[model samples]
Target: MAAVELHVDNRLLDDFEAIRPKLNGHEIGRRSSPVSDDVTVLTMEMVTAPSHARTMEVTLRRVDDQLRVGEIHYWDEHGIFIVPEVPFREVAG
Candidate 1:
């Protein structure tokens, strides 16, 4: 799959980079897969200290020059599913 261009102004892009160190070394749990002609899904697995792991799924949609993050999901050892909280939307961007 082709690499998608991300905008420097995107909030999620910054958030992901900012947390990179805390994650230790991240893993690409799933490669980018096409969900539609304009959208693709990618999953990253992160390991927290001591032994906990978190899987984050990010759905990207092509919008002009940027691959906008349309959805996000987080899962951990407790079987708890968490998502980024947005004020007015059901999905995280």
Candidate 2:
């Protein structure tokens, strides 16, 4: 598969960083795909154990010329889980 580059702003990265500690696994890799001109979906591959893994997806939307995390999703053995938007905050300039 071909790789697509996802351009994200500093605030989005900062928000992801804030929630990193809460995630169940260590991030192994990440990839992003543009859903539209205003939206992009970032998928992170995580490893919880030597043979166990999970995936997390973060949907980013552009509003007022700034990219903000709109939603988060996680997939595990149980099923897909939708994460709340409360953990993400808009950073001040």
Candidate 3:
């Protein structure tokens, strides 16, 4: 995981709907994996018209019975981009 930050342009956010995360290509809710002991990797996909799509690989780690985001990797027309932890943040005043 590299120290990186990404901000989605307003145009892309307005064009695509980001759906739920998918584990092993299946949509999941709340808990990611049936086996809690294993590290879970989920893919979140957003798509828009004209064959444009973005896929984000989210890595989760178990922490005292709770799952926490570990690393994130995003894929788009520009290729893969990685962030060490949480990728998005609200702008400070």
Candidate 4:
């Protein structure tokens, strides 16, 4: 397989960077940076988000031919903060 470009969606990466600051003091549950295959995982320890007051472990991974989301483990935290999907709508905004 001609290695699939891992970063096919740079917009996703850029949006991720914008929220990294809020993840300071996070406890990375898992992380892996592979160089031989198209699969990679980036985990971060999240402490204070835009609307949360607890720590969290976030895992971002890409493999096979699709993207997936993992459950956010937060104790007493409201929930995860995520950017809206980039799906093309039938009507233009």
Candidate 5:
């Protein structure tokens, strides 16, 4: 797959960091990188409970001059920290 060519700002990282503490689940493995054609993916394995584990993928696409978060997929449940069908704008440098 062709990797997405988008620049992600540090503030989003900061936002993620800030949001982590408030999350109910603890992240196991996390990855954020370009996937295909103007789409970047954020994947994370989360342990919501002692034995409940789920992996989620969040796809972000470039729209006009902004990068907006797109679809999200998970194992069985809706992904964490995401509003359905809502877009997240990339933080400006």
Candidate 6:
């Protein structure tokens, strides 16, 4: 699989870097497998701290110089801190 360019701007990258230390370093780990011509599935495995594993899949669409992120859906294992169910930062209960 070839590496694709990210569509986001530099500021997003900078922001990600700024808070890099806080994240567990597993939020954006992606793996890819080919499905057919012009179609590929990306598997993003997420580990939400202490001990958990969740995976998500997103479709890729090729358009000239860039690959667009298309149709994202996931098989969530529902870890302690990921997605809409949990907050990015924990609130005192």
Alpha-carbon local distance difference test for all models: 0.42, 0.45, 0.37, 0.39, 0.41, 0.36
lDDT of 6 by residue, 38-66 (tens): 32232322333222334433354656754
* Model 1 C-alpha lDDT per residue in residues 1-93, reported as the tens digit of each score: 112222122335445564444443453443333443333333333332223324445455657764555654455557566544457857867
Where does the lowest 10-residue lDDT sum fall in candidate 2? Answer: 1-10
Q: Write the residue-wise lDDT of candidate 4 on 1-93 in tens digits.
A: 011112213335554564445444432443333542333344443333323324333455555744444433343234444442356869878
Candidate 4: segments with Cα more than 4 A from true spot: 1-11, 26-40, 47-93
Error of 6 at 30 (Å): 8.2
Best by lDDT: 2
lDDT per residue (tens digit) for residues 6-62 in model 3: 333334332222322322233222223444434332333223111332445445566
Tell me the spans in candidate 1 whose CA falls farther than 4 Å from its real position: 1-53, 83-93
Q: Is candidate 2 or candidate 4 better by lDDT?
A: 2
Compute each candidate's TM-score over C-alphas.
Answer: 0.31, 0.32, 0.30, 0.26, 0.31, 0.28
TM-score of 2: 0.32
Better of 5 and 6 by TM-score: 5
lDDT for model 5 comes to 0.41
Q: List the residue pairs that clash in candidate 6.
A: none
Off by over 4 Å in 2: 1-11, 37-93
lDDT of residue 83 for candidate 5: 31
Ten-residue stretch with the least lDDT total in model 4: 1-10
| Tens digit of per-residue lDDT, candidate 2, span 6-89 | 334444666666555654444444435444354334433333321222434557676786566565455544554434335668
State the displacement of the C-alpha of residue 16, model 2, in Å, after optimal TM-score superposition.
Answer: 0.8
List the candidate numbers ranked by lDDT, top first. 2, 1, 5, 4, 3, 6
